[model samples]
Target: MSTLENDSLRSALASTPRPPRASAASAALTFGWRGMLKVRHVPEQLLDVTITPVMFLLMFTYLFGGAIEGSTGEYLDYVLPGILVMSVLFTTVYSGVALNTDLTKGVIDRFRSLPIAKPAPLLGALLGDTVRYLVAGIVIIVFGVILGYRPDAGVPGALAALAVTIVFAFGLSWVFTTLGLLLRSPSAVMNAGFMAIFPLTFLSNVFVDPSTLPAALEAFVEVNPISILATVSRGLMEGNAEAGDLAIVLATAVALTAIFAPLTVRLYRR
Candidate 1:
């Protein structure tokens, strides 16, 4: 080959891609565990996961239960799942905020300079935040049980419901993570991102029945993904598994993950 052609061939050969290894998983786990340890240093953030669930359970079950659902027992049964879903939804917003903070503080840049896997920070954040979701779910369920909010589906079913909710939250963290990376401002990302989801939770079946809502609001509640998730959760807890409800919730979660995971990875790469 000519010198120019030989030089080009060598460059192409050197640029050939190699398969990624299992070490990425180890890096993800290590970074995720590091995030968990960071949370230990700032334990106050956990208060929302542990305490707010109990407080919301009590507030809704006793204060507004009679006025809305006619009895505290019935209302507790209805709102418990909604509270669980809402707690996870609200908690997921912090993922974006935290991501933005890391970017602002150059923490992500420092990680980028390391030899770790590209997805480590994002994956680790998702895994670490899952602890928050579990704490929130357990506290809410335990308080609900104490307050007579028995799940008709028993322990296994309750656990399944919690698992679905956590998976949904984990998928949602990708969306927030992407937003955080794109925005690069913690307060702006959090406020605007959460503002978008606020109506999704409030306008849904969280505190009221869709059938009782005004026609305009009822249409929104019917279409809201949060409402669909809440319905699926309630169905599981109440042992009334409907094919349509489960399908919708699963579809929404899968769709969100498909859209956000690639976007999040792209953001991380950038």
Candidate 2:
């Protein structure tokens, strides 16, 4: 080629930005699909997602309902949302622990060497876990119905409630994934993570009414994200459609996603 043509080609190549790097979204999807495929093989994790919710619903609604809320029917109505939130809380911690396991086992390093999307592993872990969350939700809701915890809301409202729970869970996975990336041990991550969530769930207006608690506890419950999420779920399930509660739940989810998604991706890139 002529010198001028060669020079022009080099100049164009230099001026063009490398094609915008592939995002973690595709990577996340791939990772999520892989997890789903793995689940198909083992099928045991499905038990945690599907069966546990039913057991909790039955145990709480039938066993503790009368003592807690004066009637089985009344307590089921009150506890169903709490149980749903608890299920999500329990399931999301796995994301961090799983990521920690991959890191400890050198799986993460292998992933880093591949020319894959930077955020795929983290995103995939989050997405894959959503399957478990959905299964839990389905089980809880089905059993709730069987136990006379009929959602006053129509089908659409119920679906929206489920959507809120999933979105919240997704955001939470990001938080746990970041922790997993930061921690040296999976056990540490699991224990510390649950320690944090346990308080957040219990301190909220989950099983019991916030007003019935002491003033100090009531104040905390009023502001707690878990409480707000539970309120959103209740609103949707009960068909009360409280705009402020839903807004708070959505805002919390978005804020968490904004904070942790970028943080996890940054850590993964490192």
Candidate 3:
């Protein structure tokens, strides 16, 4: 290398100042805003939230309402909570898929180069995805109302139900975000997510009474976390919420965050 050019490079390095450290909250919100911008630019990113709930609410209520609950009205009341849970579950996978895509595209590398909180990108993506989850809940409730499904528990009850679902959903996102960091492709993450979610939400007492299942399967359904969550949502929205169901839902959220949050942060830093 030429001496003058080498000295110039050295001088430039010596003169450059490092960027200041960003607070965790600020960094997370910054990246979160970025995540929302991505959704804005790609409007189709909301198909799951916008279209899936309508289809599921209509399909499930009409197809199985009579056979399962003896009437469409009764089934609508029973299934709407389940559908809300399902909607959030469906959207949570996208957090992982989106993260995987960002990693693949070298976006993480850019974030790494910046002077920001290490967990900012991940936490930000999750925060941004909260919008999707909220929209899903609103869509299910609004559409169900149009189809003659009313929450007898009223607005307060409905809001409480949504609050529980959102808390659970936020904790659940960590599991998938970790998967995104570990997986080779977004498709793999999505497939694994659906495989896990479909069974948990479906096999639980979401659509039908757990008593109807075979002895062993019914046992699992009775204690399934999703089942507990759905039960709590139904109770809250229907004015029959029990302390036991609320306790179970809170415990599940705590357990999920305890187990997955550290693992996700570890993988994210890697």
lDDT of 2 by residue, 1-270 (tens): 999999999988776555666566777788899889888999986887788777888887889889988998999889998899888778998889989999999999999987777777777877888988888888888777777777888667667888899999888878899999899999999998999898998899888889889999899999999988888888899889689888888888899999999998888888
TM-score of each: 0.89, 0.88, 0.92
**lDDT by residue for model 1 (1-270), tens:** 899999999988886566565488888888779878988898888987988778888888899999997898889889999998998888998889998999999988898887777888788888889988998998888888887878989997798889989988888888898889989489999898879888788999988899998999999999988888888889888888788878877777788889998998888778
lDDT by candidate, in order shown: 0.86, 0.86, 0.90
Per-candidate total of colliding backbone pairs: 0, 1, 0
lDDT of 1 at 124: 80
Task: Using TM-score as the measure, name the better of candidate 1 and candidate 2.
Answer: 1
Better of 1 and 3 by TM-score: 3
Instruction: For model 1, name the residue pairs that clash.
Output: none
Off by over 4 Å in 1: 1-22
Kindly list the per-residue Cα lDDT of model 3 for residues 130-183, writing each as its tens digit: 988999999999898899988988989998999899999998988898899899
lDDT winner between candidates 2 and 3: 3
lDDT (0-100) at residue 226 of candidate 3?
93
